[model samples]
Target: MKDMLWLMRNIWRSTIRSKILPVYLMLPLLGVFLSALTYSSAEDETVLRIGVANLDKTQLAEDAVQYLDGLSHIQVQMVDLSALDGEVASGRLEGGVIFEQGFSEGVHSGKPGGLQMVSVDGEQATRHIKGLLAGYVNDLDAIARIAKGDETVFAELYNQARSKSVSLSGEMVDDISADQQKSRQSIGYLITLMLFFAMSLAGNILREKENRTYFRVLTAPITSRSYYVSNMVVHLFVMAVQVIVTLLVMRFAFRIDGGLPLWQMFVLLVIFALVAISISMVIVASARSTALATAVQSLLIVPTSLMAGCLLPIETMPAWIQKTASFLPQRWLLDTLHSLQQNGISKDVYLNISILLAFTVTFSLLAVYMFERNEDTRVFV
Candidate 1:
């Protein structure tokens, strides 16, 4: 016990003095800074300008134009049909809508047509306006069907629809998408850093073996397993510090509202830390030298982390790549965190936690097997 504690203290002291520790700890904050820049640039475009050209010359046509003008985040200007195309093409308007002649007559006959949309950017710029316009046409179609081709009844019913007895009021809900995205991205970067940091700590075993420190320590009363246990303790302690400090900075310092409580985030990250440690152990145990271990770490960690959506979102990847990412423990951790943030805790949280633990156990067993099979005393004593 004393021997293990002595080893643990020594490992901790060596790690604390390393300059790379600060770099690993600060990498997550870089994600936060990038997110801030992205959102700030995105906020510059707040309103959409649209041009409307109505040739129908009817009350319903005017009403449709008024509807487009009344929408939030959109500005509608009446334009001549000849000028609408030029305005949109010249970038004076994002898009344009044209209600052609007989448009109101078609609406009254329940066979609305001649509504056209034009935009340089195709559906991307016009889809929202098209959807809302479709809704207005559908309402008119419904009224025309009920009136049974009688223009007098259609007008009366439409006029009555304009003045309802009940008033409906709407309030915009607070949008937290920007905050959620920033937090998710920051944590994703942190996961990658944690894995790399764990690998660094686990590589200490290899360094000690190469330096003959492991055999020298074994000359004392400590067994190989006790020395490893001490190393694991130090590894977990550093991981905990990384997790706690990063999360604290994210919550209070950056004022990021990730929606989940701090404790939940801590629990999820700690479980992932176990997985990180286990995987690092496997890498260290499998490699015969520090150089080989580093080569393997670079080959495995960055690619797997990228696939697991630790750097970029998994959803942006191809479907096959996304499917493959599910096999990775990092993917499971990130998805679990995302689900908890979006929907709070539920039955599936337990399932995700179990899967993460399963990964840890599987990797740990594999690491033990590799360590036992390794004959190289210069790698793992």
Candidate 2:
């Protein structure tokens, strides 16, 4: 135990003295910041700008403008009739709604011209706005028929219907927030960074072998087993620091909403970190040289991370790619994180946790077996 501690201390000193700790830590922080920025930019895209040209100059046209303004996802601007086409053509407006003259009288007489939607861009925004206008016109048509050509009766009933309020009450079945998407993306990038760091640490074994430090270390009181354990301990310490710093920056500095409790999130990340370490061990055990280990790490980490939804969303990938991702540990960790965010530590959380542990143990056992069978890498017993 004492030897392991001493070995750990030395490894920590070496890592610090190398002066690359900040660089390694900076990568994950940068990833979190970039992901946050990307999500913020995307949030702005959800709102559509619409222009209204009221040529009718009647209460009906004014009411239509009010309805458009009331939509939560739309920003309505009352523009001159001539500006509507230019605005839509220049992309200043997603689309335009034009109310022709006598729109109100025509509606009352059941002879209204069809509503016109102007758009240069063939986007669904125009279609959605048209649908909203169609629904309002339909309601007005129903009210006209109810009045039976009586202007006074139509005006009375129209005003009453417009002023009428329907009470609506319902609990939110799913607490969906934009912040949840931001958290998922931030954590995804962080997981990729963690894997890269783990691989770098695992390659330290190859570095020691290259520099002949492995033989010298074995000559001391430390057994090969203690040396490997010490390395694993150091890897965990570094990963813990990375996880804590990233989470703190996300929660406090950036004000990201992590739908799960901080402790639960920390626990989940730590468990995933173990999987990363085990996979790194497997890489080191399989490669015969430092270069081969580095090459193998690059080949495996990028593709696996891509598959695991660390680099891109799993849903965007092909069906077969997503299916293959189910077999990867990173995917399971992300799944658990997503579950915690959506369901808040439900029963399925345990299942995901168990799967991550199973992956870690499997990788660890395989790495151990590989190390044991290969006498050439006797430095790791």
Which candidate has the highest TM-score of all? 1
List per-prediction Cα lDDT, in the order shown: 0.85, 0.83
Any runs in candidate 1 off by more than 4 Å, and if so which? 35-45, 169-182, 306-309, 312-327, 335-351, 372-375, 378-381
What TM-score would candidate 2 get against the native?
0.83
- Give lDDT tens digits, candidate 1, residues 153-240: 9999999999868879999897887777777878888888888899988877787778877567777887656665687778888888
Looking at candidate 1, what is the lDDT of residue 278?
88
Alpha carbon lDDT at 363, candidate 2: 87
Predicted structure 1, TM vs. truth:
0.84
Task: Point to the candidate with the largest lDDT.
Answer: 1
- The residue pairs found clashing in candidate 2 are none
Candidate 1 scores a C-alpha RMSD against the true structure in Å of: 3.3
